[model samples]
Target: MNSSAGRDFRVVAVQPQWHAQDFTSAGRFRAWMRSQLELARPHIAGDRPTLVVLTELNGLPLVLRGAGWATRLGTFRRAATALFVVRLPRTLPLLLRERVSPIRALQLADADTNAELYLRTCQALAREYGVYLCCGSAPLPRYYRQGRRVRRVPGVLTNQTVILAPDGHLIGATNKVHLTPDEQTGGVDLTPGDLNDMHVYPTPVGDLGVAISLDAFREDVLGHLGAQGCTVLLQPDANGAPWTSLEGLPPDPAQLRDQPLAWLDSSWKATTGGRVRYAVNPMVVGNLLDMTFDGQSAITGAAHEGQPQSYALTGPRGGFLALMPWVETGPPEQLRETGRQLAAGSGHPHENLYRTGVLSADLHLPPSRVTPPTPTAHEEALAALLNGEGEWPRPTRSGRPAAWLALLGLIASLTWARRRRDGDRGRACAPGQRPR
Candidate 1:
């Protein structure tokens, strides 16, 4: 464990109310972000190093400026799908032609200008705030070196999360490895990165790890981070109602309830085993086109006696900062035992507050052991499947041939039975049934 494990740190999770007009100019978006920082300033009182987390795809608005389709369709879901469908034929050729060429496909979408502006704004904000900042996730085309030349595969993009240091220098970045079906159909066509390649950023308070939106729902991702001895887990999300569907169907109503929070709590405990001292989830709020985001940003940790506690923002909009005390982790054996008990369905001993509006809290962080857990073969296989490296075991194909043979036999038997019945009926009717 790092010597600074016992040091306290303050973190501000900003849940901003986004507007379409803000994307008209980079300055407008910066101004909106600055306002959110200002709102969080009062709550962030401490000399300790602080980290500010923004929501997933918070930079999307800036990247989508001047999109003609956005103006006409007036909804992100519809606009994105329509744009992709309209240009699909043309897009396929470019994708196939440039499949091996080192060229960014952003020009086809006309998003280069906005992408540059969005990145610049994030760097500026990190420098201005002088805090470790998670600049949120953005769908950007990235180039990598192949042999001696730098190249990008066309028509492929990664939803990347950038981490900036206090001095505005790039520290770490990771791409969202899990893409929802809606995102895939909406022209996002994101390339998933390996979870093992995830960066663990060293911070003053603890080692921090990031899981963007849907990635957070995967237990393997969280477990891998915990095994790496990450003390803080940052999850940036943009959860909303009216989920985008390829079939134009409405979302399940149960999804809009408090079920997400329950899932978050359960997943955290199951993966981290109280090893990660702090878990912060910041979600985006407000309406973007027709989608309305639900902002229930939260900070959760275990209490002194191994009970979980959480401070959440239940409102639809706003910001919250939590000043958390650093507590040294317990032994590895104890953490494993705690995890086992939790897995046995022992409920939480304490209640958490579902807070609304602006809120602040000074909570104690649970102690965790930094010993990296050695995964078994089964665990490794599961991780590989989740990371898309290995395919899930399908039922044996050997049964297929047998099934087909059985079907053929049944068909032949039925044919013979029909023929015999017809022959018998004809003979009886022709020879004797006429006399009766």
Candidate 2:
């Protein structure tokens, strides 16, 4: 709906709030998402973001929440459940919804296998939504637990993404390269892929790359994407604020200190000189006990002649940043040349083939859209933590006297109970001539 050819392109990036608790029920979650979409409608209607990206588990969370009986049972039993049975049936039902499982939501392997189905979903969403969607990574079938020849039917990782046109056409996809230890340890059981081989998609807007949360932190991954003719990078992240508990008050003073921002600065600077754009959509809030996505969705880089400029969006509750319009200023060949030149200029002691060019952008440029927010109590606490303003309520040490008393009381009570029990047993045994 909104065009960005002549003036600075309006590239709006939004980090939608995510919830794992609601994932099991798609219908309820869809309605909730529609409401969230409504909150974002102002941006969509105003900016017409050619490529709109939601955080990981956007719609799938609902499917995950309302998981079919099969997934629930398989997950519960920790067994190799048939992927096709939970997803695709031997026969296609008149209604596709009844048959396809979350595992078969969209085919992820080999671009040819079910690429059209994948594309159609993207196309449909694009058409219906009137915007392009850059999907986050989802799980795809990879060899899990060596030597276990479980039926490796159709399946996808939960961290995968599907990019769609405003008309919902499939554009391109990037699987998450890095998996957290917990994820790897969990039944997710996804193997690490060669991130150095990054994929780029040439879209109506520009060449874009999708990088998931942990992968986004990798310098090699970002550099690879930049080198592979990718100018726009979409990072749908799952990282969030670490809280003590799900229901526990939003991160206490000490807890809020855990948010990581250093990696972001390094990641952005990694592809600075190149004509690439990077956008990160991290889930800020969610239902998991320890996991809570902290929204910091942003768009950076304008592929100008000499240097590329960058801008980031700072807002609360998944705010929207201005659309940094798509402009074809640097060709892939030029980018390679620039990369070579920059790498050569920055002669280091070590010969690193991956040291591409670096450029500094005037990121202070005005954000296209800005909305001020009223901080919640939790946010206020987090702000204190960020500012290093508040003191962590130190744990008060318990008195030693109390511990001694407790130990002595416990010994006394146990001894008395033991003696009483023994006496009763002896009396019973004597009267009955049998052990009681």
Candidate 3:
């Protein structure tokens, strides 16, 4: 049993630069997503499966897809306000039923539409390429299967990561057990997932684990997934601030690692000790609805050791197999400058970081991962057509949809949702309060 001959798996982290237009419409969103997948296709060969992981929030922009005004607005505050006014009739109910503010209600209302746009696109791509696609993470009302029907759980929403098999079937979904500061109260206010709910989905490559963004930083989530026998870990990241900025000081600031160094810890440190052999961190780049995210995608192996305490993304360091080209490894000032440029919204600077690229490594399946799993518990049948699959899901609440008028609120609902969620903690700036 030669390990070299058993090289049947590859992992490619797709660092995508998302913009408002990419999610302008269902067709446009699919096109943009497909183009990114095309970039990863080169890493596939020999009929061996490749795991393509897109960065977090890579598809979350769908909330703004059909809403022209939201995308055109400079800040999400004005956008949310406009959208709220237009969709007050629909948003009003959600606000009351869910006992949430305007922002959360907007997000809740648009869940079904965004879910459809995201799931449909990813599934098609997974089937077309015949690769295992970690469709990245999105905040949507909790979707569960009811016999052949797929329905959203009324008020519940989670930042969920979904995985699709080569056959385009949903293999598994893991929720972000831990929420970042920005995702909690007075923020997006999404429900945090419980650790008990984590699932390790088996793939051609191995038992796969997906930890969305911040989840990779904590041991609670990593340790639990490791205990479940994950060999490959995917940390789909959407670093809220710039990639070079220092991490906020926790209670114990004395032991903090700065920026990429903290991310590197997610590399070797996040493997569930030696149980998880490899980790892939795909990062999102670009400013979506004014909330910017930027970072270098990275892949790490457990076998490589004795790396420099500090290393740059110029090449592989420590156990990193590949890190996308990122030269802004700097003193926070660089990130601030990038922010300034973004504020101007004029020309692109450090433009390479926003280009779609793949950081991939082909590896021999470890002995532990070679054995495929025997079917266990009840697997949901590849969901039924589910009320509507072929058509772009309508956002209307009721009635024979008026071609023009009925749909106005629909677009505004989604637009407002994204604007609220896209805003830094639900508001760009408070009344008379300056934004840093």
Candidate 4:
């Protein structure tokens, strides 16, 4: 591949701390974001259109800061319990009600005042910095326009990742398709966006694709993006406690390299066969109320010929990693070979580490010939099942009889218990004259 065929652009991924105190004041949150962007500005090189990526749910603090005492006191576990199990029976009614879903209501009540502030701040930062910005992820209410008024519908919320061009234009918005089990249990009740709907946003550097944390884990999502000619992947993540164990593990360089590399291999390899050349994951750091975020923000690529390697930041440090001017590299086979060497410990783990604070590299775009395998019929069927499509198996008429019997049994047991309770009360009343 000709070196001149490649394009050069700067990309920065940031990991930031979200303190409880910051959420108490909206100005503090905006100030924090501005400071982070200013810090990243010195690292950005060249006049090439740069792309800056942030973590998921980063904007949620704005909503939290504006929420009432009830919501402020509600932890992730408590919110999940109330939203999922407690509200399951009321799902239908919530959906039917006009803008009355609990999640929507909470977001509306808390975020209504600050949502615009958060978005405007991001847009302002992007424009001021002259870079494309993946502002971060937030669980926001979905709205529809009715005549002159725009209203949020009930029972619908989207975990949205917004992309802003350097000119402050809204380039693209990708909603998360895969929701974690906890998100479902927490009464998040977010409507999943279509994977097919995600499109590549063209930039001077290359085409960019954005995915939320869990969404990045899905091969289908990455595969589709690859097919669409996206050469760069930006994932904003917020995988915190319980789901990730960051308890006692030291942030040793080895541990950092191993953990994130183990997870990044699939996506990196997928990029080898797809149009994606590089992937940047900026994860959340620090504790948010009850949840502690694990931060190992990284940039991985098959850019080098010897082996595909990752440049990662360990521990819960908040910083940015920049990659400038992408170059075209060798075939996908070289990437596979690189992976093998790394796994075998032949490749140097720390070769790409620039310093404690920054990691800069010349990214290589995968050869055009590398193509992902086409899905087979069986795989397609399994995909449908995994995506929750098609009709589920229904109970037969014979099963209905058993269900009816169970219901009757429950009713009879309740009635008997009630009569026994009444008899005991009557006997107690009659014996009242004799005093125990």
Cα lDDT tens digits, model 2, 53-87, are 55554543332432444344323211122222232
* Overall lDDT per candidate, in order of appearance: 0.51, 0.39, 0.66, 0.52
Per model, state how many residue pairs clash: 2, 51, 2, 5
lDDT of 4 at 127: 84
Instruction: Report the C-alpha lDDT of model 1 over 280-314, residue by residue, as the tens digit.
Output: 67766555665445435666554342234432211
Candidate 2 least-lDDT 10 residues = 427-436
Over 4 Å off, model 3: 1-7, 249-257, 272-275, 303-316, 327-355, 367-436
The candidate that achieves the highest lDDT relative to the unseen native structure: 3
Candidate 1 lDDT (Cα, whole model)? 0.51
TM-score of each: 0.62, 0.49, 0.80, 0.61
Model 2 stretches astray by more than 4 angstroms? 1-9, 45-49, 59-124, 140-158, 243-258, 270-275, 302-436
Instruction: Highest TM-score: give the candidate number.
Output: 3
Indicate the worst ten consecutive residues by lDDT in candidate 4.
Answer: 427-436
Model 1 CA deviation exceeding 4 Å by range = 1-5, 81-112, 145-153, 242-258, 265-272, 303-436
Between prediction 1 and prediction 4, the one with superior lDDT is 4
Could you tell me which residue pairs clash in candidate 3? Answer: 23-65, 24-65
lDDT of 3 by residue, 1-436 (tens): 2254444688888887777788778888888889889888788755566889887766556656567778777765556656655666666566656676666666766777777768878888988998888888888666545554555556677888878888877677777877875566545667888787777766667678878877887778788888778878889888765554445433343443445666655755664247478888888777666565666787777645434333332233466677676544555566546544553243666432453488788766644543333322212322332224223324556342345433554564565566546664644332212100
